[model samples]
Target chain A: MVPVDYYIILSAVLFTIGALGVLIRRNPLIIFMSIELMLNAANLAFVAFSRMYDSFNGQIFVFFVIAVAAAEVAVGLALIVEIFKTKKNINIDEMNSLKG
Target chain B: MTQTDFYTILPLTVLAVWACLLLLADLFIPKDRKGITAFLSALGLAVTLGLTITQVGRENLGFNNMVVVDGFSTFINIILLASSLFGVALAYGYIKRMGLERGEYYTLMLFSVTGMMLMAQAADLIIVFLALELLSIPLYVLAAFARPNLQSEEAGVKYFLLGAFSTGFVVYGTALIYGATGTTSLGGIFFAASNGTPGLLLTIGAALLLVGFGFKVAAVPFHMWTPDVYQGSPTAVTAFMSSGAKIAGFAALLRVFASAFPSISVDITAVIWVLAALTMIVGNITAISQTNIKRMLAYSSIAHAGYILMAFVPYGNKEVMPVSVAAGLFYLVSYAVTNFGAWAVVISLEKAEGKGLEISDFAGLAKKYPALAIAMTVFMLSFIGFPPTLGLVGKFYLFRAVIAGGYTGLALIGVVTSLVSAYYYLRVVINMYMREGDPTIEREQWLDFTTVTTAVATVALSFVPQWLFFMASTAALRLF
Candidate 1:
């Protein structure tokens, strides 16, 4: 049986990678994928905790989170498509002229 | 399982039902009748605002301590809903002009309001994260709702990316704290914190969570996205994000710190103090250099966030928490009204067909649109903390609270930065009255009416802040 700490550490690593991807990547799609990765990391932690404690509350929360993440992905992808149509480029740095 | 639970969630339920109805209603309504959705949203928001006021002093936990309905939540809820009402009114004509007058816009706005209300009431960390997403997802779409505008699209993408980045921090932090404490309940965390373990995991978790919220509120170091996103989004959406979203962020921060991590939060008090000071200085200084109206206001929003952070200086188990809550609450109301008025001026004068927001474009507005120029002047003055305005009263009360709490240095920084803010604020006035140029813009009748109504209320409220201050004082009392 694996120690609970091992699961916790693994999830943290995945979350950090997702954060780094979100910061470093310019493509809206990739940034979005990073966000999904982060959410999955959170779900993984939730499932781990539920299994550790033998409680249903953490699993119930994971269900709601999955629902909300689905909605977020649909809306986020639609927004990215709209931006791509207008800007014709997904480079994050190219969008910096909006300052005063 | 009492009647208060029903009463507590009554306003939230009202908003949800109205949003669903509006979503379905939009499918059948003609294109031109989009104004009806705005009107209905305004009415629904107003009704909820009234309902929230009825639950002001009632302190009850709904859904097993997951949701708290109390004075603090009610106060911020009123501010959010009031601003949303103003936003719907402000957006109605702008949407028609831009040809983005769809029901989705109104529905998204309604959904965002639901999220904000939830943010204020959430007692559990899990609920807070859910509420944050609920608040953010709609805003990301709204930011890019301008289909063909490249800047708008870019703003949406940037906000989405950064927003998602911050969410990761919050959730990971939450997971760590849950791991250490074995529960996600706010009360459970507080109980654990009281034991004074201050585990490394809990400390890192709390810091990461602050980073996430700090980004949301647009504080100094985490505020990189604010000016860009504000400048790119539509003017009305910018106004909503500035007022409504900032309120939610502060409310959530207060809950997490005040309730969840009170033990080790003392170690963090110095860091918050420093952030507050830096946010004030950086925001005001950057705002002074801005040539565009929206971008300047964005920076101004950052400065106001700094002021809200001052409330946190007195937050951690101090005798001054009540005063801090009062100051934060009052400032929120003042910002909601004043910022809405500023955006109302922008929406009114912008070209009926396209962009007309260069600060130079407002030259000689005093001569052409005296009413609007006067309104803008009032908002700027209130924002700068001029006497006889609610802004002045709010700032006065806020700094008094700070000084009473023995943070005279922080109070002094607030005063100096506010004075610095006045220079740029007055630049708008100087252009309107002192400079010479032509006002070539024509306003639509509805937009014209909105400008007049907002101007009148701003001036009228500036004169009689007693009513507002009285309500705020009572609301502050209810928090304790």
Candidate 2:
């Protein structure tokens, strides 16, 4: 049988990779994809724990999280597209005109 | 369970229903009739605010203890509803002026408010997370609702990215806490923390949770997105966010920390103390350097968060709980009104071409628009904690509570920084009265109504602050 800590470790690693991508990637779309990966990593942990603890609540929470995540991506990407349409660039650096 | 008990959730339920109706209205309403959406949404919020006031202290556990009704919740509900009404009114004119009037704008705002109300009432961690997303997702869209402005679009993207980043931390922390304790209810967490030594996992979870809440409240180190988002969003939306969103943020902070993790070690309190000190210093100092009025106020908002954090220093201490909670609630109410007042003036000064937000633009404003100059001066003085203003009374109580809690040094720091804050606040006044220029900088005329009313409210409350103080004290007592 697989150890619980192993699953936790793997999920943490994936989540870290996602965070790095968000920090390093210049493209808004890639940053968004990185965020999705981070969220899915969280889901992995949630499902792993649900299975370990034998409770349904954790799984139920995952359902809500997925729904909200989907909503967030849809709206977020739309805004990004709107920005790209005007600026002709999807790079985050090009959006610095709003700085104080 | 009982019929009267069902009425306890009336405010939240009404708001949810209004959100759905607004969504439908958005789909069917013509572009020219978008003003109807704003009016309908405002009416719904007004009714909810009335219901909340009438239902105060009618405690109930609705939807299986997920939503709560109590004095604290009622107080925040009133503040949120007031700000929401102000936003809708301001949006009516601003939206039309910008030619971006859309039914979806009001609908998203109503829905976002529904989420905030839920966040304030959430007793379960799962519910809190869900409510938070509900609050955030709509705001992301609204932040970018001005599709023509590239700044608005950038604001939406930044807000979404950072907001989602924080949520991941919050959820992971919640999951860890659940792993440590057996349940996700705040009561259960409190029982576990107080009864037993908080284990390693719980400690880490608690710290992570603090990070998450800190980001929401825009405390220092987690505050990178605030100035950008506040400056980039439409001025009316900025007012709603600065006031309405902030109240909900603090409500959640108090709920999670004061109620859920109240008995944690002094280490946690120490961490909060450092955050308060830095938030005050950095927010005020950065604000002084900002020439852009919106960015300056955004920093000022962060600094005000520091003052509120002083009220939390005495949390978990038995002798100081009363004064602390009272000071916090009073400060929140005062800050909400004063900040909204300041933003109302800023919005009135804004043109569709995005001019007049610079601090120098207000030069000779007193000559062109005497009433607006006077109102802006009142807001600035109130923000600076001058006497007779609600802000002065609010800060007096907060510092008193901090001193009473034996944090005299921190209180002294707060007072000194407030003195430093007076410089920038006075700068606006100086420009209004002393400098020479034409204040022909114009926008929607309707903004004058909100500006005048907010100024009057601030001035009027400055005189009759006793009632507000008493209400805040009463609300504080109920919380303890």
Candidate 3:
């Protein structure tokens, strides 16, 4: 049988990579995918911990995280598309109209 | 699931159901008569507020103890409901004038308020996570409500990205807590912590939770999106978002930390102390250089977030927690009122196409319209914590609480930041009353009403803060 420690280690690695992607990526779509990757990483950790603890609460929480991520995607993608409509490009650096 | 459970969430259920019904009713309302939708939204808030009033002086646990309806929840809910009413009033004329009138504005606002009320009552980590999204998703839409306007759209996307990023931290933190404590409920986690849960795991989880909520409340290092979002969104939406989101964020922080993690208070308090100090310093110093009024107010909101963070410095100290929490609540009241009043004035002078928003726009405002200028001056004074305003009394109570907790050095930092803040706040007052330029002032009735009423409240409430503080004292948090 596989140990829970391995699951936690894998999820932690995925979470770190996802965080780095969000910081380094310039495209809003890619940044958003990184966010989703981060959420899924946490979801993996939650499932592993739920099994380790022999409880359903962590699994239930993973479902909530999934649902919220979906909602965020709808809003975030609409925002990105709207930005694209005006600028013809959605580079993060170009969103400087209201900058200080 | 039971009578007690339903009773605990009666106010929330009523508001949520009313919001859904209002969304349906708005379909038949004529396009030009969107004002009816706004009126209906305020009516729902009033109904919920009435129910919330009756819930005071009584306490109950709901949903198998996932949420508690108690004095603290009642106190915060009243503030959220009242702010929503004010939100509807301010948005009524502003949206129509901006050509952004839509029925969904009010419904989304109502949905956001429901989430805020839930934040105040949350007794479990799951509820906290759910409530954060419920409140934020609508705001992301509302921030971008000005569709074709690139600035507003940018604000929407920026807010969404940062908000989603913060959610990742929160979820992972919750997973860690669950792993260490084997439960997602705040009370269960506390119980586990006391019974030999792994200390290192629990501390890391708590710190991660702090980082998530810090972003939500606009604390330093997580506050990069605040100014752009505030300066870009519609003025009326900025007015509502500044007050509602900060209040809800702090509510969730107080609820989760005070109830669930007092065991780790010593380790966390030092970090909060540094955060509060840095937020005050950075927010105040940055505000001094802003050329636009909206950006100025945005930084001011961030600085006040620091003052409120002072209340959490001694959250684990049983002797000082209630007093400090009450002080924090009092400061939120003062800040919300002044915020709405200031934003109302900003809304009044704000021209379509984003003209009349700079500090120079306020030049000769007093000469042209003494009444509006004076009202604006009053809000500026309240922001500066000057005499004869609620801001002064709020600061007094806050500093007193901080000093009582033996964090006098932190209290001194707050005082120094307040002094530094006076420069920018007074500049607006001086421009409004003394400088020479003609400013266009819109005279919509609702705009005038909210500005004048909140300004009056800011001054009048200062005279009798004891009664309000007395009420806040009774509205203390309870535990399982």
Using TM-score, give the best candidate's number.
Answer: 3
Q: Each model's DockQ?
A: 0.65, 0.65, 0.86
lDDT of 3 by residue, B426-462 (tens): 9998888778898888889998899889999999999
Q: lDDT by residue for model 2 over B359-448, one digit each (tens)?
A: 998899999989888889989998999976878988998999999999998999899999999988899899989999887745565577
lDDT of 1 by residue, B143-190 (tens): 987768878887887898788878878887887777667778888888
Name the candidate, 2 or 3, with the larger lDDT value. 3
TM-score evaluated only on chain B, model 2: 0.97
Writing each residue's lDDT as its tens digit, candidate 3 over A1-100 gives 6899999889889888988998999999999999898899989999999999888998899889988889888988999999999989999999999966
Better of 1 and 3 by lDDT: 3
Which portions of model 1 miss their true places by more than 4 Å? Answer: A51-54, B1-4, B352-354, B441-470, B477-480
Error of 1 at B163 (Å): 1.2
Poorest stretch of ten by lDDT in candidate 2 chain A = A3-12
Residue B125 shift from truth in candidate 1, angstroms: 1.7
In model 3, the runs with Cα more than 4 Å from the true position are B477-480
DockQ-based CAPRI category assigned to the predicted complex of candidate 2: medium
Worst 10 residues of 3 chain B by lDDT: B471-480
